[model samples]
Target chain A: MSDDRIGVRKTYKLAIGGAFPRSESGRTYVVRAADGGFLANAARASRKDVRDAVVAARKAQVGWAAATAYNRGQVVYRIAEMLEDRRAQFVEAVEAGEGVDARAAGALVDAAVDRLVWYAGWADKVAQVAGSSNPVAGPYFNFSLPEPTGVVGIAAPQESSLLGLVSVVAPAIVTGNATVVVASELRPLPGVTLAEVLATSDLPGGVVNLLTGSLVEVGPVLAAHRDVDALDLCGVPAELVTELEQLAAGSVKRVLRPPAAALDWRERPTPHRMLAFVETKTVWHPVGV
Target chain B: MNWEYAPAPESRAIVDLQPSYGLFIDGEFVDPGDGSAFKTVNPATEEVLAEVAAAGPADVDRAVEAARRAQHETWGPMSGAERAKYLFRVARILQERSRELAVLESLDNGKPIRESRDIDVPLSAAYFFYYAGWADKLEYAGFGPSPQPIGVAGQIIPWNFPLLMAAWKLAPALAAGNTSVLKPAETTPLTALVLAEIFQEAGLPPGVVNVVTGAGATGAALVAHPGVAKIAFTGSTDVGKGIQRELAGTGKRLTLELGGKGANIVFEDAPLDQAIEGIVNGIYFNQGHVCCAGSRLLVQESIAELVVEKLKARLQTLRLGDPLDKNTDIGAINSPVQLEKITELAAAGVAEGAERWTSPCALPEHGFWFPPTIFTDVSPSHRIAREEIFGPVLSVLTFRTPEEAVMKANNTPYGLSAGIWTEKGSRILWMAQQLRAGVVWANTFNRFDPTSPFGGYRESGFGREGGRHGLEAYLDV
Candidate 1:
């Protein structure tokens, strides 16, 4: 006996303010598999979408950063767990997006999950490693601690679809900064799937708003937004990086320049990424009865 | 029952000023390539203190070359322990000549002798002492192992705290094993030049620290110099932004300490008397030229009227006179241009419908002066409340609760420093956490230490200037 059935496809949309909505411009672009096969259509985010995402991120930042470090760590760890549970879906997306073999795709997905876990562990320990209690030369008590730079704008890496996106987004959110991420233009399905994982993992909405579209269209808007405190240009095209950086300077936004050489996402990450988006605040009080 | 105090002026004989001064390059005083010169005047008396050489682009090039050579040949090759010794020697020399330096600072910069003698000179010396010890222990600074110096540093400082700002820039650069070409503000180059003599007396290596004096063009030349691996600046936000834009894609390291309009919040349950003293010190210190000066006072609504009345009475008692007078509390404005700017901003406050109260203080006969003034009924949108009025002017805004106070304090683009006055411990902690500023003072105001890191968030600028974090600015991390 022969059976015939139709497979239901997922409509990949931009995640803004906890809801998956189509682009405000009402546009969608076809995303192709690595072998040029037809894949799902992804939302083509516009400048309006960029502004909306920044607003959401700004609204979410105060509460997210106000959450206890331990609680934030738990929320981040839960993201890894949810991503782990949806491993096969990400493996399939990575294989299609990166044109890698099944084994390599599986390895990338696993690295993504482990990267989230690694960053989650840093949520509570970063202050200890980066902060200090100064023995000031005075009759006073002084100490410095790290606070999150609010509302970061991240351009996810274009090539390493899953692992690179995870690598950049995890460190930012783990340090308590809400992020408006511009996912890979050509390969965005894995990023959308990861957004779904974040949504279900108890992570607050607007904390991680993912947008899939043309970087050229939205990169400058994100860079020049006065409300955005920092920019991570890890995924911006080389030709456009300088322009985006110049725009970021208009507001004196803290900019993280992209690597000069090709980066290996599977390598062990450093604490530098987490420290990049944090501001050091020193407090002084008189030591007296 | 009017009583007057006698003038107790500090002796000027301690500073032996030269008729004309040249750029200090390669441990020697040399004439500028363009031979252009400018007169340094005492803002308090309008006397031409000295004729100083104005460095052009060519002179900036010479200074950068000298610093680069020094870094590669001497400073870099030396061990951290050896470097620490030189820094210690410089610190000792500064302390030994503290009186002369302080007197010169008061004459050239127009700040009171009391502040120059006690706050500026001592803090300058303390910075060298603090960073001198960190010279050898950088590996333990938690920036990974074997951090390397970032070649030559190009530093430009504002006129507000001339010598102290120089120390804030150079001590860390030198301690981190980097040579520097420093540019002092045009109006206040005397103290920095005097500091060069101290460096020479201490037997510091030639070109390890070079002083090039000029206006903005010379600073632009130094900033754009390709040989400089880092640029550290403390000035207005506008110029800092220009420099930040100019350095795009060049990959040179940059750190900025820029302008701020800090909010000093007062709670209802606070120690009222101490809070009054802190409120006065926060804004009037340094004649309000400080970058982190608490120019905005946020008093809770319940005590706002009482605090304003008390502040007015306290203002009347502040003596505004000659900077050399030991009894002077408020000194002359730094320059005529700054005085005019302050006048214009204060006028705007009046034009914008805020009530202004000027202290009953007589002005000096021949110098720039502005009385200690405060504006009540100041809305958050007022120009005097928002823009940095780097003069003896304070804007008073009232808040009803802690949340409203935090909201108003963090509303500005600049986040440099803030003050909180309350008797409650948990409230202080909570307020400190809510503020977006770099430095927070609880039950006190305008307190600084070499061991504390100082910088700003947002447009106020990035990177730190003191403590262990300051070393990162001069190192290739």
Candidate 2:
């Protein structure tokens, strides 16, 4: 069955508003394997692209958040199912981009799939864990519930492309926030492929917009975006964290700073990530017949 | 026939005024390192009550050092039960001295004596008592199995509810076993200084709680200090943003309870009399110095004119005069600076073409006073409807549908608090879910309890101040 045929290569593009399009700047950057072999050219997203993604995210946020929590859970779990189906493709991308052995890459892909399933379970349950029925000393029946912080801007981790990107994006969207994510600048193939999985998994368009570009250029624009209600700076460069934070302060965006020490992606995730971007809304009504 | 009631004044003799005061550091009243002093005046009469030390950077540093020492030596290593006892004592002492504290608070903060006596002072004591129980119950708080304190907390509170804000910040931090360096707002430092006396009478350990009184520069120094691990501030949105920016990469935990222009929505089906009372309490209480005051009134268009007419008639009954007068419904503005800001913003409302209707109450000549005002036909774009005037000014806007009401209510960057008046239970619940605010009250407004968590969303800032959720701010999760 060995025939002399050339295999078609996939064209890498930015995912914004559930559609794959070339960067508005019409720019592309070369992506190389660990051994410096040219893998492919990825769309180099510009500040304009960031702005478009934010608008898309804002547009989709209300609908996505309005969906029943159970429906959201199923949609997230569907993403896991789709990712599991494309495990081999992600393993190959991770292996090349991260300079890891096939087994290591496979393990990373498995963890990413499991992370999605883990977050899927939280979509419906997070409110119960994070919210409370306050016993106010009055005639009022008071209760507090967690609501999603509107549009979140995420900078995916520079290392551990697939797992780290999945780790950040899942917790954000599972809590019903629409996201504008800047993927791993050096190795964005796995992130874009993950976007493909998301697009087909019944996730709403614009719920998860992925961009591949320089974080230095895109980070500030995303941080400073007035439409963005929150930020996850897990992958922001150390030197730029303060500057980006200052920019984020202008709009009072809820910011999650990077860990002081490098995180091990293999560690079991905590609910803190999901809770960080939620606002606890307490409602009161008089207790009367 | 015209009838008038004689003035019923609350006795100022309840509070014993000191000629001069020093900063409370290391459980002692000490002079500021920089020998600078400022006079604190009673806003109702512009009478200089006492000369208070103005703490500088050196004082802030010393306070932080003392707090850090307390954390390491007395507070952190102590058992939760032992800590609970101290907090319990503090609560008891607060309740015992509440009358004196309330009188001083009214004098310094320019709030009505009724509010200071009934709401602010009692709530301060209630906060201490509530957190006192939580001191020994950390494991059940759900943060973790053995949550640790986040070292010294630098607490900066606004002047609006001076002693109550102090209680909101310190009770939780201390109950969680952290030491504190508190910066009381410059205009209202008297009650907090008296609170220091209560802490001493409770036999609290030296350096456990330090009070530094100064202006913005001292607060800036306290915020920038390296030894502080957490910062809990309640103030304007602009200053909150500045503090957030300053602590950018410092790894310090922060919780801010900032400003808001809350909306109070009234539907046609609402109980008319009760809704009118709620509307008055929502904005006119505390002279509208409250951060979560319902400054924006969103009424059902069918009843908008009726509501405004009733509101105007009700405003005329509000007595605006001396804070010590028990019958007075509205008090003096906190300071000349705050009065000027309110006047400027109210003028902007009139200039922006909103119809302003001010009450005909006679303002006292010697004090800072602004008549209770209402602006009808206020567009969402009007400055009065958008910005936090922090005075007795209410903006009235009408909407035809529930959806429009929700949309107009959430139009601002602030999401601190809101109120809904409707007899229908389902609509109340639906509006509560739709409005993007931290606290939503149905059939009531400006109601607070120690067990109820209070905070805000969006640009109004983050973190709850009361109940179980407040423990997370002081704990290292």
Q: Give candidate 1's error at residue B110 in angstroms.
A: 0.4
Sequence-dependent TM-score of model 1? 0.98
The estimated TM-scores of all candidates read: 0.98, 0.99
Docking class of 1: high
Q: Each model's C-alpha lDDT? A: 0.94, 0.94
Q: How big is the positional error of residue B284 in model 1, measured in Å on the Cα after superposition?
A: 0.5
Q: After superposition, how far is residue A254 of candidate 2 from its true place, in Å?
A: 0.8
lDDT of 2 by residue, A51-116 (tens): 999999999999999999999999999999999999999999999999999999999999999999
- Model 1 lDDT tens row, B134-238: 999989988889889999999999999999999999999999999999999999999999999888998889999999999999999999999999999999999
For model 1, what is the C-alpha lDDT against the true structure? Answer: 0.94
Interface RMSD of 1: 0.8
Residue pairs clashing in model 1 are none
B331-407 per-residue lDDT for model 2 (tens digits): 99999999999999999999999999999888888979999999998999999999999999999999999999999
